[model samples]
Target: MPILRNTKKEAVIKDITVIGGGVVGASTALHLASLGYQITIVDQNNSNIAKNSEHRTGSTASLGVLMGNIFTRHKGRSWELRKRSMEIWPELIKSLSTEELPIIVNTPLVKIASSKEEMIKMENLIKQKKYLGIDFLPDNYQSLPIWIKNKYGGLISYNDGQINSLKLIDSLFLKLKSLNVNIITSKVKYIKRINDNTRIWSVILEDGKAINSHIVIICAAAESERLLQQLNYKLPLTKILGQAIKLKFKNSQVNFSGWPAIVNIKGINLIPEQPDSLLIGATLENELSPDKKYLHQMLETIREKAEWMQNYLIKEKWYGHRAKPINEPAPILKSIEKGLIINTAHYRNGVLLSPACAEWVSLEINKFHQ
Candidate 1:
């Protein structure tokens, strides 16, 4: 272990440095800290270049849906990751007693099928997953709230929920500060190997200072590939661009905060945010310039199902990139070298997979000592 030393030449503590301060990085650091590891987090906070970049990264922009049994296509790695995350979410939320935790709205999700074909597709999917606590509503849509429109019925998935992404980020930041984790708001220029024979490394910051540590975990999202390539590891990953908007209803009687989020069979989601406020999103594009026609099509899809949205205006519009491994659906969690690990490529499930990803990485860190 590399000892963190003070100017007095005294070995204070052994340090574990985590790069990327986004939800995955932050959550990983927190889990390591809780396990009594002296931790330091290095993040540029520059969205343009950092892999685990955090300026309105997917974590902040997400509608915070823990979508285990909702709109997912199959029970693949994506489904397993979400299932594990949902299992640990409550315990993780309750553990944050240092401050008021983020608002995790434990409401059902209403998956509305616009056509009989779509309904049949959803019904077959339900059978494949055999998920509990979710039931297809009556053909008359009796169980769904009065606000839900359209003619077809819906499936209500219990315990599927949403959270305030901004608030959740705030709470995580606060908890990290309280834990005395050193958070450096600077870019890591690159990593330097201290020795070839020994498993030791140092992160070279933009300011030319080297932060030495025994373990260096790279949670940088799309940026991880470049950093790893510099060290001769080829990580095949790509970035997908997505856009979403927030809207507030003009009518005071319209309240969605307590109602279940409406997941259109056509890939649009309406998540309740605050009183009369809702989050509608998101368009995924791989190219730099998203096709305007495709974006318009998504908007048209949303309007077709929920005519009530005509009463509200867009409150905010934003777009960001999500990371995905070239061929893998699950996140990449592995030790690249003796003291180096990489955890990224979460794609659209970053928020949903935060806890599970953090736990998986932290366990690897623990295993290194044992």
Candidate 2:
């Protein structure tokens, strides 16, 4: 193990250095910190880039939809990660709540079926989920909200909920601060293993600063590919552009209380915000720029189903890129080497799966040490 000298010239064992300060990275730091590991987080912390909607990270641009329970896949790594995350979210929210950080929006997720095929799939899932003790409301047109106009009805997953992504990140940083985790605001230039025998790694920052640690976890999303490529590891990651629009209901009398976040079979989400506004997103486009037509079409689809939205005014539209794996499953959660971990490429479900991904990283570290 690599040891460093403190100001008093005493030997101090180095610990973990996590690259990336987004939701996944922040959550991973918190998880590791709670486990008594000395943790350091290196983030670029570009305020101007974060402010620009087009350049915002996936977590910031997301509508914060937690669709774990509603996901049709009942088996595989994806489902397992979603299941684990759903279990952790409540505990995390409660812990954060003690600090008066209201990051979670407690509401069920309602997934509406656009076709008979989707309804059948939901039916089969309801049966399969019942065996696992996952509750799902019976699909009934009358059971849906008054505004939703779907002929095939919808399924409600009470266990699923949403969170404010930005707020969650902020609260996580505060929690990390209370835990005394070191957070560095700089971009990582490259990462290299300092000693093969000792398994110690060095994270080199853009400003020529090197942070030495026993373990390094890469949660830098699209940037992970570049970082790994320098180490002769090809991490194929493609950036998928996603756009969302915020709209406000013109009619103040519109009641959004107790409303569940709605998701269509096409994967577009219509989330109800506080007051009389709704956040509708997002389009997975391959192009560079935000396509206004995609947002328009999505809005029209929602307006067609929910007539009340016809009178709403467009508030704002934003876009962000999500890192997706090439020819591989989402979330690329695994240790690439003895001490280097890759936990990025969550794609669209970064916020939804962050807690589980973080826990997985912690478990990997423990297992390796054992």
Candidate 3:
């Protein structure tokens, strides 16, 4: 597609280049386009995978599924934004309609209460959060149809949704096309300014193609550092390795289980999906052997808590690095200098937090004008 031009000054942004086409990058692209910036999304997977995950195995469920996890780790603005993300999630889906909508599947969550005190804590949290405002606590346990039920009443977070990550990105990519945003299949090396009078910026690609823009945003994950390094920009970032498995429990699938997304778990989380597939995520271990026995242990850890999971057969497997941002959310979207921006380090909650983070970054990019 040709570069879109606008006669109105409000629509004039020298062009913005979003490097990395994953969740953070992809979301940034969409939001930037909405702001009327001539935007180009650069990715190695442009024509092939096009916005695939690092593990390529991300939870497509609603942000609501991870609310419990965030609550335990955050309390102030981070907590508030995460909660807001959950609220905005459904509405965003309605607007984007970019991917196949998540199926409202029942989840079979297996929660283990270590003791009476733990159970009390769980019960109290459910009440407080529920009584206070939007909470993760599910209201019903007795009405469940599945045989799997917590005798001590494991807190169930009702009304969670799930999506296929790959499909979600593709949908968003399609939506960008409708807005005339361009996505290129290549890697960005650096951002350089040319023609000072106009303040026009050019994105130099590894393949030697120079794409011009007014602003450049970095959204790539672990690779964000290397790309930035070429320009002498470094942020405290680290790569954490993650592994998971997908299983299908055909007849035993939980219909009330909205992916049975787990939260506040100590070590790992088991997120469920339609029909029989269960998404099992494990420890944030690094330098570990990829031995079959090790992978089996991760699966076993997830299956151990759920007697229901034993019925499922393995369908798919996943492994990838999640970018751990140093400091906090502010680092990724903060403006380092003129015409240069970044959006990365979303670690575990990338999918859940993508929209709000993208909106924030896009707005920051727009702020350069003001």
**Top lDDT model:** 2
Clashing pairs in 2: none
lDDT of 3 by residue, 1-370 (tens): 2111212245456477888887678777876676667788988765334123334422222122334222443376676556656665666666666235443322333344445676777666656554434243354544555433334545555433345565567667777888898878877777777877776778888888999877778777767778777768777677666666667776644543533444334345656555445566654655423345656776665455445556557776656666777756532556777777777777777776777777777556555643
lDDT of 1 by residue, 10-110 (tens): 22335789999888898888777766778999888732232223225766666677776664455666666677777777777766534345455556777
Q: Could you arrange the candidates by lDDT from highest to lowest? A: 2, 1, 3
Cα lDDT over the full model 2:
0.79
Model 3, CA-based lDDT: 0.60
Q: Show model 1 residue runs off by greater than 4 Å.
A: 1-14, 46-55, 71-76, 97-102, 124-131, 138-150, 251-258, 262-264, 289-294, 368-370
Can you give the lDDT of residue 253 in candidate 3?
Answer: 44
Model 2 agreement with the true structure over 165-259: per-residue lDDT tens digits: 77787778888889999989999999999898988899999899899998999999999999999999998988899998888878866657656
TM-score of 1: 0.85
Off by over 4 Å in 3: 1-14, 47-70, 73-75, 98-124, 131-152, 195-199, 250-267, 288-294, 326-331
Clashes of each: 5, 0, 15
